[model samples]
Target: MVVRIFGISIVVTVISLVVAYLYGGVEALILCAILGIFEVSLSFDNAVINATVLRRMSEFWQKMFLTIGILIAVFGMRLVFPLAVVWITAGLNPVKALDVALNPPADGGEFFPDGSPSYETALTAAHPQIASFGGMFLMMLFLNFIFSQREITWLSWLERPLGRAGKLDQLAVVVASISLIVAAEFLTDEANRSTVLLAGLLGIVTYIAVDGLGSMFEVDEDDIDEAAASSGGGPSQLAVVTGKAGFFLFLYLEVLDASFSFDGVIGAFAITSDPIIIALGLGFIGAMFVRSITIFLVRKGTLDDYVYLEHGAHWAIGALAVILLVSLKWHVNEIITGLIGVVLIAAAFISSLVRNKRLAPEADAEVEKSTPVS
Candidate 1:
């Protein structure tokens, strides 16, 4: 499995190096490697969530995720999304935007080059809009998780209260809306406040639409039971084709993947302005690694083994959401964003270990009692 996961990584790296050498020699090759690492480190939590969703899906959809999904992730989000941002925010057509992205104007090493800004400049200028949209979507996703009434919880002290609050219908929407207003009013520049607010609202709408669609198509217990009965007397791990429900879920996952990549895409500019370099280095190499990680977690059932892993991933997402919003006003270190997730997951893992240790004794005693002198 390890080899399978990394086989693509090795191939991607080699291709990246070849592309880099063709484009800009050894320097571009090194940049590609670094960007790949950057994407993987920042997106570990994304893999966890993808696994959580992927495990529910049928084998066909799962295969689609690895095949067609990879193209959408690498090119659509990493390359085209950035171009779209430039085109929409800067009043350039897609073709022109693509051109500018490929050949950014010489900055003379200036952060904000003067007069008719380069592709990076235009894209970076749209950061407020991008951050607001992605941040709000992610914020809603996190709040919905915490507010959900669940049997298992890692941070019960906080989660329990939130879960209760979730009883208020559309509470996640309310919280997200308020958060967006606050961000626009206080955290964003006056010139871009409307843009931020609009983008943020669209983000909320997007999430609501996707989530509502998923709920509408969700397989009911009766349906699952019917499927089970058709097969045999009892429930079985059958690959029940969910059809429409499954397809919507795939859409949801794709949107979710986009939300996670927003910050990474913006942050890539901090490294270089060449869109090709960004796509090849981070999109091709790094995004592939993230995909492999998702496959690994799903195949291995790692989430089941580590009981609190899901909780940790959601917490990390919550942190990332908050960071994305805060980044509107402040320059957050990418490393910090990545580390927060790593630390939370590590802590949750330790907590799971302690929990298992405590439960083990009870299980042993129950087994001994049942043995009855056997």
Candidate 2:
């Protein structure tokens, strides 16, 4: 599985480079590789979380994740989403925006010769908006992690109550909505309040819709474990339910992937505005790494061994949420976001090692007692 995953990553990277070369030649290839590494480093936690969810999914869904899901990730979210945001906020025509993105200014001085805006300039001009999107998006993701970890199942019980209040309690949607309104009041120099509001609404709505779909489609964890135990290394009953279960799992995975990508995608604006470059570079490479990491975790059963890893990732995600919320009121650097996640996960990993070390002696003693002759 590791070898296969590596092969897949190589194939995807080569294909991305080929596609980029056809579009923008050597420059695109170089940009893709660089951004890909940056994205991968920043999103290792994303892979871990993905593995947890993916393991619960059916094999068919896993295949879908690699297929149609990748298209949505690469084209729809990474490419079109950012471009759409720029267009809506900056008031640039979509075609013109694409043109400018494709052909950046010569010296980064002037993007357009006819006094029209350049892609770089447009991207710079849209920094606050992108920041706003990322800030709110990350906050939502962090909140969701907190909600998930708590004993309280908000969706299971409070779903109807929250619905009764005629309001959305999902943190991401709320933050995005509030950010849109705030940006409307203070940052309306570019996009209309409605556009920002629409964007926020879309983020929230997509999350809820996807989440609901996931709930309906998810498999019972107890059932899977029981089947696995009974099968005893043979094909488990999970294989039988793989089709429908896998589809739902795949959908959930994609949604989670999108949530993780939000900050990175918006941050890419800080580097460059070529949608193709952003999509091919970040999208292809990032997704490939995510896939490889997921396979590694699943095969190794790392989650079972390092339970704290998930806890740490969730806490880091929570911190990221707060950072996103604060970003609404201030200028929060993207590097800070990435750093916080790294620190949280690193701490968790170290703690896990410490815990294992402390328990090793007791475990060895118990093993010696069990082996009487030995």
Best by lDDT: 1
What are the runs in model 1 whose C-alpha is more than 4 Å off? Answer: 107-114, 227-241, 367-374
lDDT assessment of candidate 2? 0.68
lDDT of 2 by residue, 106-155 (tens): 76765456776666565555545444444445455555654443432223
202: Cα error in model 2, Å:
4.8
Error of 2 at 291 (Å): 1.8
Model 2 misplaced regions, further than 4 Å: 14-29, 87-94, 105-116, 121-138, 147-205, 221-245, 365-374
CA RMSD, predictions in order: 3.1, 6.6
Q: Which lDDT value does model 1 have at 123? A: 80
**What digit string (tens of lDDT, one per residue) describes model 1 on residues 127-185?**
88888888988888898999998898899999888899999999999999999999998
